[model samples]
Target: MGKTTGFMEYDRKTAEERDPRTRIGDWNEYQLPMAEAELRKQGARCMDCGTPFCHTGILIDGKDSGCPLYNLIPEWNDLVYRGRWKEALERLLHTNNFPEFTGRVCPAPCEGACTVAINDPAVAIKSIEREIIDRGFAEGWIVPEPPQTRTGKRVAIIGSGPAGLAAADQLNRAGHTVSVYERDDRIGGLLMYGIPNMKLEKSLVDRRVNLLREEGIAFVTNTEIGNDITMEQLQNDYDAVIVCTGAQKHRELPIEGRKLDGIHLAMPYLTQSTKALLDANYEANINATGKDVIVIGGGDTGADCVATALRQRCNSVVQFGRHPRQPDERSEDNPWPEYPFVFTLDYAYEEATAQFGRDPRQYSIITKRIVGDENGHVKELHTVEAEKIPAENGGYTFRDIPGSEKVWPTQLVLLAIGFEGAEDSILVGSDLEHKRRKVKAEYGQYTTNLEGVFAAGDVRRGQSLIVWAIHEGREAARECDRYLMGTTRLP
Candidate 1:
């Protein structure tokens, strides 16, 4: 620990955000930086307990408790508290290949598992991490470090998301020639498109990609395997193949009027919006301008859609969730150390409440049908109030209440329910086995049924956080390294 009673002396403080009204005008990040001194004080709040659970990468009740990337949280916290930012940056990069991404977007489960959180507020780990990395970038400390020698073994990675990029970084560090293939025009699969720019700017993604390029990792964009290039060619040419193609197969709400013209999936809508922003041309974009939008689903994607619609100057927005409202505090059944199931206002909900007089979320409501006009454009949405009932399989099912049907005007609807699994177009001719829509690979090994074939990230584990994807990719690279040589030094 940097200070003996630092945890008691200093209270946890985090980064502030720009006014919602001002931030909504542009697609830039809203987080305002904290002074270096306040950030150091926040870092000093880390108790650094003897048995720190912040770094333990374990799952309790099937929810992440600690840092999934196994980041040296306490070590870095102490380094930051002592003003040893360069050492802190090194420690942050030891496990996480891209702290910039996680520091911005990760939900920060480490705070949930913090020892100080048992009594008072947890340390501002995410904010401290962001400061360390941002400072590193500003001071020109973050530069590409290519491997000293090449192993003469070429490896191919499909889908250039967090997992693919992480695996490529590790493999390159292990002296392997790594080449990443991305179907999209840009390298980041989900980071570049699925996520909105206000939360994480595209420039940050490009910065990391440029650093990877300097590290001797080849990024092949607009080229897909099994289509532009054959799977057989990959197997023959590359010493190993890692499939990090994220779960792009979005889940659909195939209900009444499902094929309506004004309805769309969340990813394509989000992707198109980002593309338009990048091109500096707003015409012919999938925007919610001058429309009353209804976003279906209650997860992060739905929240993102809500924010995106607000930014596009939508007249009104309502987000629907099928389940009941979560409690403000954790119940006995949902104790601490597991992901807190309590209700907290995300950025979108806060923005909506600020702009409009009320929160835009409507819980315990199910979409019955999408009402369309004579011209086939979506005009309104019909919904019914629902309640959860105990099911025979120890689960709950929604039961619609009679005489509770209502209709609301909406010109556009975005389905942000969730992803199903990996897309089939790329995996059709591959040798990898699959379960449901996900690629069949074990947790630690990350190997497919075929020899020398590996899978990771959402493709293997289903939809998850970016930190988990990085962890999976790193482990997969270690396994791949071991497979290539009798012994390996990768960690």
Candidate 2:
């Protein structure tokens, strides 16, 4: 829907990032904005394929294939290409509640599934989306639009993550009185603290949250539903409760020296670091300064740990991953429209390489145990080189190689192994049915065992992407609206 021949004429380009060496010195956003002319050119790269899979929002091989929020990529790209920034922003806001967050953090499965990506580089849809929203804000087009009328229905959303915020926004727009509860002292659950400020500036989160406040959504911070307020009181206070507390129970490493000092979970470390930064303390509770750091795991969390360690001025850093390095290009089993299983340097790796003279990732490595000093603090990390072996059930497992065990000196270890599920505390007093440690609510319906109670996001679906969380939140809000009003009009 963009310029007819633009896809063939212009090459795909994205926003340039600040130099890794320079950006690591502080906790500011690393990405530098793309010029309006270049952004329009990137937007023009959207091809007019008969079937645009960029927004299909489907799963292929258990991987995200496109925009989980089903964003109007083509329409917005066309609008951006035609210089209709306002129209593009409107179309973008129709699907995504927070493009600023996704644009900066989401892995951009939409680009991976883009039609243009079949033969060449994909359109820079994420960058164009961010520009539209940023421009909207700059032009003062984005503002609080509280519902003119109230339906007298009340919905209490638990959690202030993207999911909870999205649900609150949609429910509030539906003329329902919505109150969001966050256990933390501030709003924006993961957005406020779990993520480091370098990835997403907290001010941006506060900006949107302030807009939501003006839009008539009541936000109650430092209030835990099951603790500060019981489920009974919550049920009596609101017509419905949507749980979006997220999968926060981190997976533990129950090996030797597990309880040693100087080892911490990844989320708490990130949270403390960001909290300290926001509080102007400029010192994290789990400071990595002048220490040898070892990160156990891979993916975004591990990478973030590596970057945070570097920013904290750690002496050295290394990350362990059980899996082998990915191939330079997609393999036969990984075809088009399936999120490409290929290797590319992430921002954290770039910063680590720039600072340390090499990438910090050590693949095909398994942590055998943690060795502590006499003081009971972490002194060394024991590991062994491993290889992936296919199991009888068609799954894969790692096998440690003989005579490959080694010990690396380290004072701190960060476990980014991932999360198990939602914390059980939230479900203690309620009879909410659960499976696989997550709330057992069907995807579309989002209804729990208790009447007038709902669930969504990571708490309901297990650990997932921010985009998926927003999608579930929007859908759950729609379903809740239907239940509240009988007939619904929410999209």
Candidate 3:
């Protein structure tokens, strides 16, 4: 609501990008920054609609509108429009603990649901938000704000991804001693590994981790619970324990030739490549050099695989998905503010299309088998045509088309079918009970069956967006605080 006539005056302007060729040469962020003047214009585009769904952050029609954390979007946009960059950053950080991460990685569900998008293009909210934070960093306004004093109570978090980190941030702000534990050699779970450095630079995560450390939020890497330390010890050592380990068990494709060497889980492949790039690895890295790679799955992770393979000098890269090609525009089924399924090119796909003759995506493809070479390594993928059959139930089923099988030339096949739940490595003797072995936490409660234990994020809710994880973390922290203390003030 910066200006009544603002939405009419400005068109949506997002940040530009570095040339694909130049950006692909390195494993860092490629999104170019917008000049302050242009950014101000973009800020002015905030119509501040009467409904203002941008801050609602609710899932309407199965899509997210506004910031899930209820970021003060219009207020900050007004601040940015008036050239008060520091104030804008303050407003951005008021609710969002890590705008730096979300500003870049989030799918911007808010913009998709923006009221202006009904007739005109939505405001460049994400870009302007990023601008606010980057300007804060440039002005040295972003600093570590550790707790002034510590309460007698102590807490332990079992993961360092956004969920755990968010919980620690809240609990520590509540004056409790907080220590995070991660099984990986590094602190971040998926943030440090599952995502590629090119998309979300590892250094960015490291920057925040370093600040968390400086703020006295103890982080213990390589100290996995239920292994390095016992769950009983954790329950007794700390007043409360929170499990924020992300859902990492990738759904398997138990098709023919499933054990082929070249076919690997998408996350592990992405993890290995990131660890190699970050020197966080002391093991053999997965490389796609001089290989024709077929990454099965059309999600962001699969796209990252394509980008990483290109950096490793892959001969060719092709991606496959069972879903049919979506319409270029949002369909009636995909209405406002809910996450709409539409055909849009991500950066990785854009780079691949620019370098290769065509876009690397093959829609309506269902891999039936992994074709292998003489040495037992996968050399190609056997796929069949697939169709979406609307089921009697709400969910649709994938129907295979007869005689549509074909072999796709490939040396590496990465499955990015998404995660199932938290790895079973840390569940033993944790006092947490599982309903059918799934984390048994009530929706919105986030409390596990075990006493004094809570779960959130992908661990509790399964694989989801960073925004949802952060939301759950915040809610879980509040619940934990209430359980620990007689009353709570956390929002």
Candidate 4:
């Protein structure tokens, strides 16, 4: 409990956002800082409940019900309310390895499960977490604390994403000589290249990487394990190996004109943009400048593509979702305390509406084909309207509406339809068991079929949130430590 009557005395107030029109001109993070006093008031809004569900991570109806990291939401909220930011940061770090990353990008399932959210707005947990970490860095309270002694044991972590980074951090803290290998030129894996700078600035990732380096954790970039090096070499060089290679296999659309010049996958486009930004080169081969862009897919990646195209000064933009639009409010089946599948305006949606004077999303639409010009470049996209067909079994299917075809002239098409699983190249000769495209490992054990080899994050659990990746990474590191030292003192 933050305050006896704090919930009744204060209302939730989150950080302000930069104007969408102006923010679309730059790649920097668009969120403005929240005043310390105002943030304290928001923290005071946390209710005194017997059992706060916000910190209980559970899966209900195949959806997240609370924070996956099992963050100490009430403790931190009370700390923030009492102006104990240093203590709040310490509490946040107890469960989450990187509050900066999750505070910026995580969808905040904790808020949905808040007891107060049943009737009123949830506590601003994510904003408070972000503020605590940012203040810690600004005040120089966050410093690299290397282990006291070396254990003479070495561990190798593949894929430098959140999961790999979390594992590396834990293993290094346990006095083990840890080395992380990344195929990308820079560390931070997807954090470095996958996400756009607007949502999460690159400088933040670089800052953490520098701290990790100063703490004696070795980072090897531009060297992949299975390709540049071999699995046998990894096994021979290290005491144990943990594969955190995330699911990078992008789903593709096998429709007409799929091989056109102007059509590209979302990851490559986003990666190229970030790389070009870092290298001070704006002329990317897959740029969307002066083109009419059509982004297919309705997930976060698709929204990111739309925002990128807008920043690139595309002439026009449109997004398509295969399923119909959801209700503005929660439906009967989606009750409180469960992640609500409702329609909400995201940053890209707001920007598109502001710039174009209308929402760019067209629900219940399916792309039939991609039309190309004589130059063999994407020129237009053909789509058909979808109609919902109800069945007696309380299920439904989508049927294409007849005579509802439409086409739009466009030059760039980005497929942001999500990912399947880990790439096959890395797992080609590995004697690891798998389910579907993901490596098979028990939830808590994190052990693969092969001895001394483990898998975690999206590679084992499929596509998931950054918090889950961090949790898996930490758990996998503990298992690896136990395997090497016969026991682990790590949390």
Candidate 5:
């Protein structure tokens, strides 16, 4: 939908990042701005394939295949290629509630499924998207547009993460009085605290939140639903209650010495670091300065831990991943139209590599146990290198090699394994049905057993991408509006 032969003429380019060595000193965003001409060239890389799968918004074999938000990717790419910035912004905002957040954090399945990716590099959709929204804000084209009429229906969304925020935005625009409740003192949940500031600046989150407030969404911070207020109270006051609390119950490693003093979950560590940056009077409870750190997981969270430890001036850092390294190119099992499983260096890893003179990730490693000093602080970590074995169920499992046992000295251990699901504490004394530790609700319906209560995002779907959370939030808002007004115009 861009130039007729643009895909053949132009090469794919992405936003350049700040120098890793210098950027590690602070918490500022790492990505540098791309020039308009280059960004337009990136937009022009979009091909005129008859079936554009970039916005298919589907999951193939339980993996994200395209933009879950179903963004009008080709249309906006064409607009950007033509220098129609305002039109591009309109198209972008038409589907995405917060382009800025998704542009920065979303693992763009759209690019993985791009038609151009079949034979060549994919279009730089994420980079173009970030530029469009950033330019829109800079040009004063983006502003608060509160609904003119109120429906007299109220919605209470629990959680200020991407999902909750998206639902609130949609409901508020549909003329419903929406109040977002966050347990944390700040408005944004995962955006504000779960993620580090270097990846997504707190100011950007504050900017959008301020805009949301101007557009008539009430925000209640430092309030817990079941504690500060009761579920019954919200049900009585609001027409609908949407549970977007997210899957915050972090998975734990139950190995020996897990209860050591220096060991911590990844979220709490990230939260404390961010809190310290925001509050001058506060100091981070867990400091890694001059200490040997070992992160036990290889996901984005683990990489963030590695980066954070480096910024804290740790003596040395290493990350352990259960899975082996991914291939440089897509494997046979992972084909086109599915999110490509390939190895690429993320921002955090780049920074760690630059600072340490080597990558901090150690693959195919399983932690046997932690060893504590006499004072009960982490003193060493025992691990074993494992190999992946094909299981009878067509899945893979790890088996430890007998002679690969090793030990590493460390003072701090961070577990970034993953999340289990929604916290059990959030559901206490409530009749909410749960499946696999997640709130039970159908995907499109999003309704709970209760008449007026609904659930969405990670709370309902388990741990997923930010784009999927936004998609669920928007869909849930539509369903809630329909239940309230007997009809809904929300897309």
Candidate 6:
């Protein structure tokens, strides 16, 4: 509340982006940062609402609404408006551990739940968030706030993704020596390898990791729980164990020609593409250069695949989805204050439309089979229109329409149907039992069948957002701390 009338005085503004035609030529960040003055104006737009619903991280209609990390949105916005950036960074760091990562990649739920969004555009929360953290890094304000005293308790957090990192951060702040074990060659787990670099620069991830290392946190890389060091040994070594290994298993297309050479799971394809871009693809690289590519599933992962493929210079690219295209306007059933189920173009779609002369999305379509060449390579894809019938339960049922089959030239087929759960190989090897393939832990507690072992993040709750992962990790940290010490104070 720098100015009493600031919300009315300023229009919401955000980061700009280069057009697809120009940005697709290089594998760099397309989201252009907003000028400082504009960012300040956007920050000033935060009204001094007495009950700021933006930070009220509560459940809405059974869905996790608002900021899961409960960021001090209005406080920081006002601080930025008053030119007190350092103070704003402190407020921002009050809850969130990594604002830099969420600032870039997260589809901000806070803005969606903003109180100002009743009629006007929502405040540019994400942009201001990114600016605050970047300012912290540039001004050297970000430091490792290691715990003051040791509790003589040890904890092992498997998987260094958002969840594992948050759990470790909280436990470390509680004066417990935390050791993060990552199966990957590097830390940050999905943030390090799964996500494309352009959307979120790896430098930001590395910067936080470096700071964590400076704080005396021991990071053991390439050491899996069941494989490298058996879970039995982990329990014997540590007082408590937290399973934060995210869901790595991908859903598959159980159709003909599924064993074709050019077909790949979304995670592997995305992971390989990121590796090629950073590590430089070698002899047998999975390059989409000058190839016809079709990405299945029209979610963010699919869009990321399209963007990555375009950057790799794919000749033609398209994405297909099974459900009917969403409507442009929200229906009466979906009134205000609810997450709108309206069709809107995302960044990837915008880029593809600009580069490829049309939107890459084809809705209400289902892939029947993968048409492959004689030598066991995917050549083309066969698809059919999915007809919909209104469901008595207030939804719709899909049926394969007749005489609507078609094929698209596809040298590469990336399946992005989303992940199911974490790989059970390690869990089973650890002799941990599970419910629905997830670690069978009682609600409100992350305890597993094996004593002194717990699970969190996608591994515990299935595939979820980074914010939820962070929350679960923090909660699990408290439980683990309480288990080690009869009483705990860390939150």
Q: How far out, in Å, is residue 484 in model 5?
A: 0.4
For model 6, the superposed segments whose C-alpha errors exceed 4 Å read 281-284, 390-395
Best by lDDT: 5
Ranked by TM-score, the better of candidates 4 and 5 is 5
Between candidates 1 and 6, the TM-score winner: 1
TM-score list, all predictions:
0.98, 0.99, 0.97, 0.98, 0.99, 0.95
The RMSD of every model to the true structure, in order and in angstroms, is: 1.3, 1.0, 1.6, 1.4, 0.8, 1.8
lDDT of 4 by residue, 1-491 (tens): 68878778888888899999999999989888899998888888888889899989888977888988899999999998899999999999899988889989988999999998888888888899899999999999999999999999999999899999999999999999999999989999889999999999999999999999999999998997767898888988898999999999999899988999999999999999999999985567899899999999998999999999999999999999988899988889998789778898898999999899988898999899988889998899999999988878888888999999998999999999999998886667476788788999999999988779899999998999898899999999999999999999987
lDDT of candidate 2 over 1-491, digit per residue (tens): 98899999998888899999999999999888899899888888888889999999898868889998999999999998899999999999999999999988888999899999888988998888888888999999998899999999999999999999999999999999999999999999998888889989999999999999999999999998778888778899889999999999999999999999999999989988888888885666698999999999988899999999999999999999999999998899899998888998999999999998999999999998898989999999899999899999989998889999999999999999999998977867567889888999998999999899999999999999999999999999999999999988988
Off by over 4 Å in 5: none
Candidate 1: residue 79 lDDT (0-100): 92
Q: What is the C-alpha lDDT of each candidate?
A: 0.90, 0.92, 0.84, 0.91, 0.93, 0.84
Off by over 4 Å in 1: 281-285
Model 5: colliding residue pairs: none
Checking candidate 1 for backbone clashes, the offending pairs are: none
Let me know the TM-score candidate 5 reaches against the reference structure: 0.99
lDDT of 6 at 380: 94
Candidate 3 runs further than 4 Å off = 280-283
Tens-place lDDT per residue, model 5, 99-139, is 99999999999999999999999999999999999999999
For residues 1-491, what per-residue lDDT tens digits would candidate 3 score against the true structure? 56678889877889998888788788878898899888888888888577878778887755566678888888998888899888888888888888888888888888887888887788898999887887787788978888898778999999999999999989988989999998888877888898788767888788888888888899888887877898778888999888898887779999989898888889888888877777754563578999998988999999999999988889999999889998988899887776667899889988898789689999999887776889998877788998999998878999889999898888788898887776777665466776533577886788887788899887777777898888888888999899888789898
